[model samples]
Target: MSPCSSVPEAAESVSRFTERPALQSSKTLRAAGVWTGAQQTRLNVRHFEFTADEPHKVGGRDQGPTPMEYLAGAVNSCITVVIDQLAARQQLTLEDLQTYTLASQDTRGLAGTADVQPYAHAYRLQIAITTPERDEHTLRQFAARAEHICPAINLLRDANTGLKVVWSFTEQPTAEAAERLSNAAVGYTEEHDAPKPFLTVTNADLAASVSA
Candidate 1:
C-alpha cells in the first residue's frame, strides 16, 4: 500500500475505483505481435507469450494454430465465458457445453472480383448445451443475453459477418421447440449486415519502438 493522506481518503479512493464504469472495448489493453519470418507471428499479451502460425502448405512450418484458428478460438472462448457468467447469475446448473464455429470465406475479391469479400466474411456458430434441470426457454434466454453482450461475437456481428447461433438441447426440448428457440437466438433475429474491421499496419521497427 502506498502512503495515504488519511484512512477516510484511502477508503474514498477505493470506493471511487470500484464504482468506476467499466471500459467498453480494448481502450488501454495492448498486445504486441512480432513476425519472426516464415509465417510465424509471436505475440505478447499482458506478459503471456504465445504464437500464431500457418500450415506448411501455406509457407509456414506448421508450428501452431493458424491465425484464422486463433480468431475462431477467441470467439468460442468469449461466448463460453459470457454464458458461464450468465448461468452463474441465473443459478443454472450446466452439465456440459460444447461449441463449434463454421467460418467460410469467399475469395472472389482476392481474385479481383468487384464488391466481393476477400477475408472471412461468413460465419455460423452452433452451440450444444446440457443442463440437468433448467428449462429450454431459460437456456435460450441465457444464450441470447450472452450473444448480446459477448464482445467477440458482437464484434463479428457488428462487422456484418453472417453469424447465427444454432442450438441442440440435451435435456428437454422437442425438435420443433428447439428449432423455434434457434430461430429466436440472437443471430437469426437480426437483419443481415456486412462486417468490417478497422486495421492498421506499421513497419516492424516502428512497432518495436512503440512497444519498447
Candidate 2:
C-alpha cells in the first residue's frame, strides 16, 4: 500500500487530540518475556508474539533479531510514524518516507570484561522523504518537530545516547533515487540537544487522602 494511504485517518486522529485535550492521558504499556533457552527469549506484547535471540557467534541460534536490533528498529519506526502523523496534521503532501538506522555498541560491557556502558553509545538515522515543500529550512523544522515528539528518540536522548540524523528530500521517489540515497554520501545532518531527565514526584497529599 502507498505510505500516504493512512494520511486521512492520521489527520482525523490529530484533529481529535487537538479538539479534546481531556482525551489525552497517560497510558501504561505492558509486555512479558520468557527465557526459552540458550540466549533466546520469547516475548509477548498485547496480541503479538515474537522471539529474540543471539547469533551463532554469540552462542545461540539466529532465530530472530537481538534486543539491541529491536531497540534500533523501535527508534526508526517511532520516528517514521511521528513524521507521518505530523505531515498529515500539517496538510503536507508526503509521497514517500524511508529511514535507515545504525547503532554503535561496545560488546565488552555486555561481556563484563570492561567498565563500559552496555547499551548503544550512539545512533544514526538516515531519513529520505518525498514531499512538496522544497524549502530546506522548512523541512528541517518539520523533522525537528517530529523528533521532539518521538518517544523512542527521547528515551535514548534522555539516557545520554548520541544521535545523528541525516535528511534527504526529493520531489519524486523513484527506485534509482532510492538506490542513490542508500549509497550516497551524507547530506543535511542534525544533532539535537540533550534532553533533561524528568524528575519523579510523590503525591503525598493523594497518598494521605487514599489512606484516609
Candidate 3:
C-alpha cells in the first residue's frame, strides 16, 4: 500500500495519544537475515521476506538492493510518512509529496581503514511537496516538524552523520519541476566525493599470499 493511504488512520491514532498520554507505549521492531551465498542474504521481517545482495561486480548475484540502499530508503520512507501524517493533522491539502535520499559512505572503512568509518558519513534528503499552503514560513514550520519527529532521520543524526535536507514547496505539481527535482537528487550524490578503496592490496597479491 502507498504510504499516503495510511495517513488518515495514522493521524487519528496519533491524535488519540496526544489527547490521552496514557495511550503511548514503546514497541520493538525486529528483523532477521540469513546468509545464503556469495554476499547475498535472505531477510525476514514479521511475515515479509526479501533478499539483499551486492552487485555482480561486487561478487554477488545482483538480486536486490544492497544494505546501504535499504538504509537510505528507510530514511526516505519514514520522513514521507511523517509528512503525510502531519499534513492530515494540520488540515493541509497535499496534492503530492516525494522524497529522494542519498547516503555517502567511504568504502575504505569497510576494508578496515583505521581512520574511516564503515557507515555513511553524510546524507542528503530532497523533498518536493505540492500543497495549497503558499506561505514559506508555514511550509518551513511543517518541514521542521517532520524533521524533528522522524525516527529514521534521528537515527543517523544521533550517529553524527552530516544530514542536508532540501525542500521545495509548490501549489501545484508540474512535470518540468519533477524532472528538475529528480536531476537535483542525483546531482547531490554526483557532486560529492565518490567512494574508493583505500587498500593497496591487489587480487594478484592476495592470490600469491594464499599460494605461499
Per-model TM-score on C-alpha atoms: 0.64, 0.72, 0.72
- Model 3 C-alpha lDDT versus the unseen true structure: 0.67
Higher-lDDT candidate of 1 and 3: 3
The better candidate by TM-score, 1 or 3, is 3
Residue-level lDDT tens digits of model 3 in 1-212: 23232223333323212342222343447889999999999999999999999999879899999998988888888988998999999887898777776667988888786678789887767677777777655665676667667888756766657776767776666554433554545674342232221111112212333554
Q: State in Å the error of residue 178, model 2.
A: 7.2
Which pairs clash (backbone N, Cα, C closer than 3 Å) in model 1? Answer: 159-194, 159-195, 159-196, 160-193, 160-194, 160-195, 161-195
Model 3 alpha-carbon miss at residue 46, Å: 1.3
Question: How far is each candidate from the true structure, as Cα RMSD in Å?
Answer: 14.5, 13.9, 15.9
| lDDT to native, each model | 0.61, 0.66, 0.67
Relative to the unseen true structure, what is the C-alpha lDDT of residue 98 in candidate 2, on a scale of 0 to 100? 76
User: After superposition, which runs of candidate 1 have C-alpha atoms over 4 Å from their true positions?
Assistant: 1-27, 108-115, 172-212
- lDDT tens per residue, model 1, 63-157: 88987789988988888898789889888887666666777777577558768776578776756566675454565556556665677875676
lDDT of 2 at 95: 86
lDDT per residue as tens, model 2, 1-212: 23232223233323212342222343447889999999999999999999999999989889999999998888888988998899989887888887777678989999999999999887666667777786655665676667657778657765656766656676666553433443443332322211111111122222223454
lDDT of 1: 0.61
